[model samples]
Target chain A: MAKGIISWIDRRFPLTAIIKHELTEYPTPRNLSYWWNFGFLAGFVLVLQILTGIFLAMHYKPDASMAFDSLQTIMRDVNYGWLLRYLHSTGASAFFIVIYVHMARTLYYGSYRAPRELLWWTGQVLLLSIMASAFMGYLLPWGQMSYWGAGVITNLFGATPFIGEAVVLWLRGDFAVGDATLTRFFALHYLFPFLVAGMVVIHLVSLHTVKSSNPSGINLEDKDNIPFHPYYTSKDGFGLGVYLIIFCWFVFFAPNTFIEAVNNNPANPLVTPPHIVPEWYFLPFYAILRSIPDLLGGVVAMVMSLLLFAVLPFADRSTIPGGARYRPIYRVTFFLFIADIFVLGYLGAQAPTGYVVPMGQVATFLYFATFFILPIVSKREDKWLRARLPQELLAQFDRTNALAKGQNKGDAP
Target chain B: MSDSKSMDKPLDCPERRNFLEKATAVVGGVGVAGASWPFINSMNPSADVLENAISEVDLKVIEVGQSQTVSWEGKPVFVVHRTPAQIAAMQASKGGPDPQEDTARTQQPEWLVVVGLCTHLGCVPTRDNEGWLCPCHGSRYDNSGRILHGPAPANLPVPPYKIVSSETIIIGVA
Candidate 1:
């Protein structure tokens, strides 16, 4: 009887074994810091976006006449529809926050170094796709911001050299950003999250192929690593719970906090808002686009900003520091890159005039320079440090390095 | 208590068993009560309720030489009230081969009422001097709800409508 009962209980509760396998069997590098958690957090945010977006789409109207009213209906009528809309809107912002942090984590820890370069490149592409998805979603409501934002962004394609106007018209489906544009944008916006999800799976698969790098910058060499279960699982769960609480707060108490009130008005083609600004996340790139006096140059600058991420693996010279005990210059340059991004974001929000253009150009130059100068700086610094190291310190380093090497060979699968 | 305990030794006392059962019942009762709110909230509208609900629209607000819009079943309905002059211009245009064989085949004459949604992916058609324009996919409709130069595969739908009063119309009713 007792055996039967145990078997029944086991059949009813299979989650335990699954959890154990995920958490205990999976080996995670011991050096992983809080930075590693953002990838998981980004994944969590992606799920949230999909859930909220699916709900919102149920009550949303894609047509021009009813689009505004449909939004109003969702806010006013459908059960918990307001909650769904707010969650989706705010979720977009939160998604960007986590992705930016994830990218920063990569930069700081040199997670973009070799073998993981493809993973980082895929992540960069995913980021660009996310931005595009969000931009298209912003236009679905047919509100003032949706109208003008779509118009301005579609017009950006017109900045291309010879066939710019034709490309812009093709994108618009008409001479302007109207019904055709909104319909296509809605379709693409709805479709992109799934693509991003696919990319994320690939990113993780690639990530797992190479052992995760830790803050110590050390690669795994032995079974000193802990299973991902109770250790990291509990840690990530706690992180998720805290994140959800903040997300819920935004959804419940401050649904419209991120939405501009000016966007509440219907889209007017003839009337241009005094200042046209892209969403906050796009501001840095937008600033770069505007900094160039010529249209072609502005387009090039904007594209370059995104393309730089793909080239990062080869940009910096520092040998993948097996540990963080070295490479101070790389760290400083990483911070400078962050500062440049923030400065560019600020400049993007300002009107294009006087010092804004010049400042943006300087920032844009520095942004590219960080990538171009990294390898040279890393090589020079490594050479200097090797020559200047004391004999005693060098001897100790050699002993520890050999020990680590021996451990690595022993631990290999 | 001694008598009850002695009785419980053989078969559980009725009062004690009843009390324990009631306690379990109360706990389950409270759980059901706690869960009912969100459960009911998620239930879909009944078929009967949906059947009786407003699925059509009235297009009386449309004026001659102007277009009027109404919402039916959460979609836009455009009623173009064309003047005699506008109707004549539509008849004269021959720039492209006509998608519709007979312009006179349409039931509505001076006032054409169509589901304002574009044939290509359903963006609400906006009225300009030329005709109805879909801002979503660039599909355009002529004054008589016929597909003009656009990717629209079909003309705008005309909801079944009737004039209830000089200024009022009822749509989606036979």
Candidate 2:
């Protein structure tokens, strides 16, 4: 009976053979730190967003006239609709935070090296797609903020060189971001997250194929690894629980903490707010885009900043197998890269001015220099190491040491 | 012996069974509690009756060539006290405002009683020279609550109304 019950439970649960193999056959480097857990955390947040967003969309009205009223209805009427709305809104912010951390983790660990370059590139594209989805979602409420926000953003196309006017007109679907634009954005915003989910699955599949890199910068050639089951499974669960606690706190108490309530008022096209900033996640690129005086140049520079990640693997030439133990130069460049981003974010928030022009130029220069500087520094470090070891001397020393150790051990016997 | 020892334990442990029972009871309790609110709210004496209540308006408040609005069934109902001259002018401009010129149009003349909502998107139509104008969706309705232009599909709804006193009107469910 006991045997029968055990078999029954195993059959029902059916821990997939793949999972069992991952647990028993494959061994992860034991030295992995908390940073390694972020990818899984990001995946978890993606699920949270998709689930909550789906429910919110059920009661949301796509039409301009009813959109605002529908949101109000959800807030005031539906059972626990307030909770669902808050969860979705707060989940968006939380999603950005986790992805940023995950990207930073990859940067610090040098996880973007050759084999994982495609993974990093895919992730960058995913990030860009997520930003688009979020920006579109912000305009769905048809509130004052949503209206003016869409107007200002869609008008950016008006900055294009020859066809700027035509581009802007096409984007608006009417003369401006009106009912048509709102309906289209609602459709795209609902569709984009699912695409992001598909990209994430590919990211994980790629990640598993190439075993995780650890802090020690060593590869596990033998059976030194353990299955990913009970060990990593428990670890990921604990991390998820802690993240959920923080997520729930924001959902319940401060859903609008990151959003402007002015957005709740009806959108007035005639009135423009003093400062129009994109959501926090896009602030850095938005800053870069604004840095250049020329509209086309600024747009190009902004696109390049995001696309620059694709070139990172070629720029950083360290053959060091593990992720964490980066050379000193790489470490300093990483911090500089972070500082450049912060400076750009600040510049984005400020109006383009005499001081901002120079600051933006300097920040942009440093941003590109970090990528170009990596290959040179990595090459120099490699040569320095090679010069320090002479092959014949190393071989002679090894032979002498072996003979001496053997003789000493034999004498003792 | 190892297998026999394991089998000796019961299929349902008392501790596990008790925990399951408690969990189910807690879930059932919450379900019951949640189900009671709507039931209790529905039972209130005024809940359903108040929604259909009629409103009384003082027609004297409305001057000649002007419109006065009163609440009926949570909606605005417009009552216009027209002068004999104004009624004659409206009749002269008959086909100009009322397109169909049906019985509904013929019925509305000196005292216009129509729902004060835009037939297009349900915004409360603000009174203007051309009768009522919806701020949202830009639908226009003439003084007789006839659809003039824009996307409004039909004319404004006319509430069931009766003259209560010389200067008073009562609007209720027809």
Highest-lDDT candidate: 1
Which numbered prediction scores highest in TM-score against the true structure?
A: 1
Q: Can you write out model 2's per-residue Cα lDDT over A143-196, one digit (the tens) per residue?
A: 876776676567667657898767765665554456767887898899999999
Q: Report the TM-score of candidate 2, chain A only.
A: 0.86
Candidate 2 regions exceeding 4 Å error are: A1-15, A22-26, A158-163, A322-324, A385-413, B1-174
**Total clashes, candidate 1?**
13
Q: Taking the tens digit of each residue's C-alpha lDDT, what string does model 1 give over B89-156?
A: 76676323245532542355676777775554345667788787665435677777778765455777
List the global CA lDDT of all models. Answer: 0.73, 0.72
Clashing pairs in 2: A23-A227, A23-A228, A27-A225, A27-A226, A109-A323, A144-A265
- Per-prediction fnat values? 0.00, 0.00
TM-score of 2: 0.63
Q: Could you tell me every candidate's TM-score relative to the true structure? A: 0.65, 0.63
Q: Residues A1-413, candidate 1: write the lDDT tens digits.
A: 98787668779986556555455777788767677788889999999898888888888988777888999999899998888888888998899988899888887887776556778888888998899899999999888777877776776687667887677656766545666667778888889999999988888777666657677655565676888877888888888888889988988988787787878888865444555667888999988876675556777889998998887777655443532246666767778889999999999888665688689889888987887887798788767766877877666655645554464456664
